[model samples]
Target: MENNMNGQTAIVTGAAGGIGSAVVTKFIESGVNVVAVDLYQQALDVLIEEVGTSGGEIVPLAGDVTDPLLAIRAVELSRSKFGGLDILVNNAGMGSDMVPLWEIDLETWRRDIEVNLTSQFMMLKAVIPGMIEQGYGRIVNTASAAGMEGHALSSPYAAAKGGVIAMTKAVGKELATKGVLVNAIAPALIGSGMLDQPWFDEKTKKQLLERIPMGRVGEPTEVAEMITFLASPSLSFSTGAVFDLSGGRATY
Candidate 1:
């Protein structure tokens, strides 16, 4: 097995969720020390137990990713536990309320942006300096196909993810000469637990499924595979780009 991350440290936010947990597992499988941050302590405990059984080193930190202080704490925790950080996976995000645009409240919109966009920016701000000093880093921001192409009843989420995509490109270029690569992954209709939320009613779920050309949702592990590749040292060139996982639903 190729150990691309034999001595590296990676921080994965939302590590308790399906997609985030998959990414954490992949990183650990690749020999990377992992700092898994999430808001749920119970879920984190389960993740820790599972990773431990595999002889993997994973430090779980329970906190809300949208909290500005949590990002700083995560970076500090990674440095303290693993000695340093090499990769940051901004996977902490939430879907918007399945309400129409007119029915969406300002607070809900703001919260969506805060969770899906601002949190990533804060994480990047906290991690980039260390990467710059070391002259090596891989930052993978999770965007969405809804961001690339708008989804009905998900305007705020789409907007936030769209901002994430744009921010990734701008930051990638800013650090292009510094050997710190930044990229965004746009996934659509992945069979993650996020779909189990109350916002996803039967009608909404049907609407979502109909949009996918493959007529099925993707697996979290499949998405994790792509993320692992992007976060690995093998990705040398290719920053400020978006990789699609939309099941051919992406017209662009």
Candidate 2:
């Protein structure tokens, strides 16, 4: 299928991780230049080296997503390097420790909210003005099934992802007539760094997998494909919608 994404520029947060890198690679293959953002310089360097040979241009930025300035810088970098920003992938996020809500520390809860929810807000704040001025844009925020159907022992992550879903809906409606489409993806148990954390032990993984009627975990590449579609002109007429990647687990 023709993605109609050639020569466009995008900023993808969490660009060094499994799902993020997959999205980056998919974007490049579709002829899109990218401004990739992540927390570790070394990981970003490795990502650039790997995807640099793909097809489209890619520049890497290492910074904390929680820092609002990083969002501004990323938007600026996309314009300065690639002429204009056409897409924004709010993908940078982390999972919280597997613990009861009462057992979670206040700082941990705040961190979870900061990384998963506030960071997306910052990116939207920075990128929306340019997109509005140009009268065109595509935004794909990464949400989670945990948000839709709250997860036990993971309240903070659930709450933050839920916020992402709500925010995407609100923004999508606000830009529906401006030729800028905003949507979100709610993925469950994707094979990524977020799952590789120490908290996701065998028992947790097994339990999550069993919840899926498909009886398996999702691949990062699968997620990349869906995200690429959402970020393309081919997806016209859809905004504030949430696509599911839950291996048949999402009933809504």
Candidate 3:
């Protein structure tokens, strides 16, 4: 696929995680300048050092993705460093506790919503204006199959990702005629930091894998490939859609 994305600029949240780093590397290889965002400076530094500067420019801006101000700073950094922004990957998210909805605390529920859903909204709020002014932009949000099909014990996560799917559709319609395309990806299970959590014990992993017909977890690079497509000019005419990376787990 000819992305035709050379020299374009993007802001990728969760730039240091498994999926995030893979997306950053893929974008860089596609010749897209990136303003990588993550919470810890050290992690971002490690990712930058690993990906290197061989394909396109990459600069890190460490901050909490839940912070609205971080979104503004990231936008400023992208514009100043790469001239203007052309893409956004709202991939910064986390897994909630393995407890059922009734067992989950209010703080945990609120945090999950804030980090997964509201943070994406904050980024859209910060970056959409410039994209609208330019009349061209690509946005690929990271949702989850949990949003599409409810998870047994992860209500907050499911709720937040469901909100992302809804928000993506709304924004896509709002910007459809303005040359800005907004879409989302829903993946059931991909090897990432989320799986490394203590709650994801062997039994849980086994159950999750059993749901996938592929019989194996997806790699981060695979997710990156699809996200890169969505962020490229190659993905015109599809907005507010959710691309599945579910390993056959998603029936709809």
Question: Against the hidden reference, what TM-scores do the models get?
Answer: 0.96, 0.98, 0.99
Off by over 4 Å in 3: none
User: Would you list the clashing residue pairs of candidate 1?
Assistant: none
Q: Candidate 3: lDDT over CA atoms?
A: 0.94
Model 1 ranges with Cα > 4 A deviation: 1-3, 53-55
Better of 1 and 2 by TM-score: 2
State which candidate has the highest lDDT. 3
Model 2 pairs whose backbones collide = none
- Please report, in order, the local distance difference test score of every candidate based on alpha carbons: 0.91, 0.94, 0.94
**lDDT (Cα, tens digit) per residue for candidate 1, span 1-252:** 353777799999999899999998888777888999999999999988776645348998999888889989999999999899999999999985687899999999999999999999999999999999999999999999989988888999999999999999999999999999999999988899998998888887788789888999999999999998899888998999999998888887
Model 2 reaches what TM-score against the true structure? 0.98
lDDT of 2 at 108: 99
- Order the candidate numbers by TM-score, best to worst: 3, 2, 1
Q: Residue 20 of candidate 3: its Cα lDDT? A: 99
lDDT for each residue of candidate 2 in 203-228, tens digit (9 for 90 to 100) = 99999999999998999999999999
